[model samples]
Target chain A: MRSQSRIAFYLLLTPLVLWLGLLIVIPHIDMLLISLRERISFGVYDRSLLQYEKALTEPLYLRTFARTAVMSILATAITLIIAFPVAYYIAKMAKGRLQQVLFLLCLIPFYVSELVRTFGWMILLRETGIVSNLLQWTGLADQPVELLYTDATMMVGLVYTSMLFMVVPLVTTLESLDDSVIEAGYDLGGNGFSVLREIIIPHAMPGIVSGCIVVFMLSLGNYLTPTMLGGKDSLWFTEMIYNQFIVRSNWELGAAFGFMLLVLSSVIVWGMLALTGRTLKETMG
Target chain B: MIPTIPTSRAFRLTYGAYVALFFLYLALPLTVVAVFAFNDSQFPSLPWDGFTWAWFFGTERPQIGVFHERGILRAVGTSAFVAGCVAVLSVAVGTTNAFLFNRYEFRGKGLLYVLMLLPLVIPGIVLGISILIFSSTLANGIWDLAQMDIQALRPGLLLVILGQFSFITTIATLVISARLQKFDRTLEEAALNLGADRLTAVRTITLPFLAPAMVGAVVVAFLMSFENFNTTLMLVGSDAPLTIAMFDRLKEGSTPLLNAVSLLLMLGSSLLALLVILFQRRP
Candidate 1:
């Protein structure tokens, strides 16, 4: 009977395993192989490391990579800074339906597609748009601003898009935190700020770190937000990979760029796990 | 609990201001989209001439003829069809996989779970491109064996469905798995001890317990597939999906029609979510 049940279990597992293997694992292996090859004309691979060498040594590619990393790191930092207070407020202060309402409001933006949200920012930040108009109306600027196609706008869109992902985990973790810990700190004669620093922040550190990692990963993989809001000059690293494949038709180079992204993201995931002292499985579980 | 400190009107006012300001920031864009949908103007962003349903109804006027572009509608239909198929397939596969994972212990179980979730963590662009390459190669090999000429298997609906199912199934599996963990095993054991086969036990005792979770998983999968832009963009054929269509239209310039679509989608999704919530609340 045990052997029969085991057979049934393996049978149930077969299709899903095959589906993932055929679509994900095998394709990833192909990408790895393609990354090692040379880019012949018309985007075909020519079985060499010529493309990888060029991608590694090219200043343009290197600069774009560094710029994307810095921008993603900054965006992650800004999101955490903004989200931490909101999560804390919701977890600690708000009660009952009000908390649910506020949390739902945070989730509403996520319900809409990212493309639409990014377009909303584009309209608001355009030269003749609301932000510029408001700045001019308030006498804060002498002229209408050109903030639309810049790193600042990209940062705004990235942070806005990723804010909910950061907040949800923080709120869940903070909700699980015992209020008595903070009360104990206070009973020990610690002030409000001191209690927050000594007790609440330490308890929430794991969530904070995981939230940052998620935001960073999403931001790094995000090509659409930067492309739409930052315009042609933005040329984010993923956008560069996109251009190589779609516009330039340089498959080998695109594969190399993709592999680099994979490696970078994997390293970030590993570093986050080490820092938080938890595996990915633990976090997801 | 710490006693509440009261009698600070200034601090309350400051907090209120901050909350209000952030709420406005969140709602401003959605408000713009909702309002412009009703504006009767040539350009989408300009002042409202009058209230009209010309964009939504597709009426023509001599001075400014109504834009009769059915591209968005067609793309919406295509996306709906693909998302529907993806939802069904993913839920079936995911539920089965979740049940298997939950009910069994085996060698390499840890590795299997990780492999299942790898697609979720990988970037969509990478997934789309890799799938494109792999599918094309597979199609070519099959064609070579058949000795028939075929167009390059670059992009199409099949690829889109396959691409979406890759990650969406994982999401369904995770959600259903969570629910399954809460299931009471003794009920199934009771059924089994009463001379029911394993299949009969599952059908009578276990499936009813899993029905609500299965519904939620299906809805989530459908929504995820519908709103998916990144993977869809990469894998879509010559025809665009609604999100892609709207994006292209925005690239040209903003229009109230886009706003019209946004309002419709928002209302639709809210209603759908409400229905699900109501269903879950049912005894």
Candidate 2:
């Protein structure tokens, strides 16, 4: 019976091992190798960091990388600011059926595909869009303001798209907090700000960290929303990587950029983890 | 029950308005998309010419609606096929892995657990690239090994499935394993003592218990694979899914037909999500 159980265990484990080892781990290794070696001919290459140097040295690539990072950070910060109140109201104020309904209302929009969601934005912000029409109708402007390709719309799209991710985590963490703790602080003459600083924020740190990590990674790696919404001048890093791989057939350069993205996620995730003092497992959940 | 924090009437009123505006922001874009699908105008934007079903059912060559458009119908078919393959492959592997990880103890288990979750952390684009590189190299190695022109194993639908499966399977495993961790183990032990074998015990006892999670995993896997863009963009060779097709249309320029398609996708997914929520809360 023990031998049989052991055999069953091994059988169950083999598929996962093979799936991860062969597909994920080995591919990442291959990507690393491809990134390191510079292609000399159709089938020949040498080990060098020329791709990395080029990514750094090229003004276009460097600007794209910096722009992507800055926009992603701004998106993350803006999402947090916008999401906190709604999350707080749901987790703290709203009760029973109202909370459930509101939470579902927040989540239903997310059910639409990301691409579809972006398409919805495009419909509204195009030259003949309602916003532009409204401006013309109000006599605030005589012509349609082309809002589709601007940074404001880009920020709006990023924040809007990621609101659910931020809110869900914050709600989960905040819901678990004991309200009496806050009441006690209020009763003891502590003002709203102090109570928030001393108790609520401290307790909700893990959720904040997790939500920030997700929003940051999402906005950073986002290709569709930025490219589609930000239009021609978006200079989104992901688009550059996509261009390298598909358009230019520069796999080595693309692989390097992909690795740099990996590095960025790791760094931001690590930084958040460090600041919050949460372990990888805890923060991820 | 916990009492909420105290606030003044002014604060409450402001918060209420803020919440209402938030909901509008969330719901407005999709509302425009849905409404504009039937708009008689040439464009998807405002100043609706009149209401018409042409966007939904156009039968002409260039002004084709979503349904009549052969490329769209074909892409939908392709998306469905890829999603189906991914759902099945991922769920099978995921269910087995979940049970093993949750039930047993072994060497390197901690490391394996982290490694299993590594795919979720990595972006889809990176995974797509990795798989593309790895598979092409693998095809060439096989060619070198056996003087056979077996290099037809490059990018295509199969690569799409495999690339999607890499992460989707991990997600399914996480879902099922979280459920497994909470299940009572003594039921299986009692069944074993009653002379039932492990396989039979698991089939009758554990499988039923895990049915809900398995369903959720399958639905999520299918939907994710269907909607996937970045990875699909990288790995897809000649064939384009609905997302790729829609994106291509977007790049070229959009028509009300695109809005028609978005509205359909929105309705279909919202209905699916509603069903999941209803069933989840059906106790």
Per residue, candidate 2 scores C-alpha lDDT tens digits across B1-283 of 1245567878788888998999999998888888888888777877778888988788875567788888889998999999999999999999999988888999998888878877767878888999999988888888889966654457789999998999999889988888888889999889989999889999999998888788888888988898888889898978888899999988898888988888888788777776776666655
Please, what are the lDDT tens digits per residue for candidate 1 over residues A1-285?
Answer: 888797888788887888888888999898888778864555455778887789879999988988888888899999998888778878877888999999888888777777767766766788866677788889999898878888888888898888888999999989988877777787789877898788888888878877887898889889779988886667798888888888897777888888888888888878878977887776665
Q: Give per-residue CA lDDT, model 1, range B54-153, as digits (tens).
A: 6777656522222455677788888889889999999998888888889888888889888887776788888888887787767777786997645446
Native contacts retained, all candidates in order: 0.37, 0.67
Q: TM-score of the B chain in model 1?
A: 0.91
Could you estimate the TM-score for every candidate?
Answer: 0.94, 0.97
**Residue B194's lDDT in candidate 1:** 92
Per-model DockQ against the true two-chain complex: 0.54, 0.65
* CAPRI class assigned to model 2: medium
Whole-structure CA lDDT of model 1: 0.80
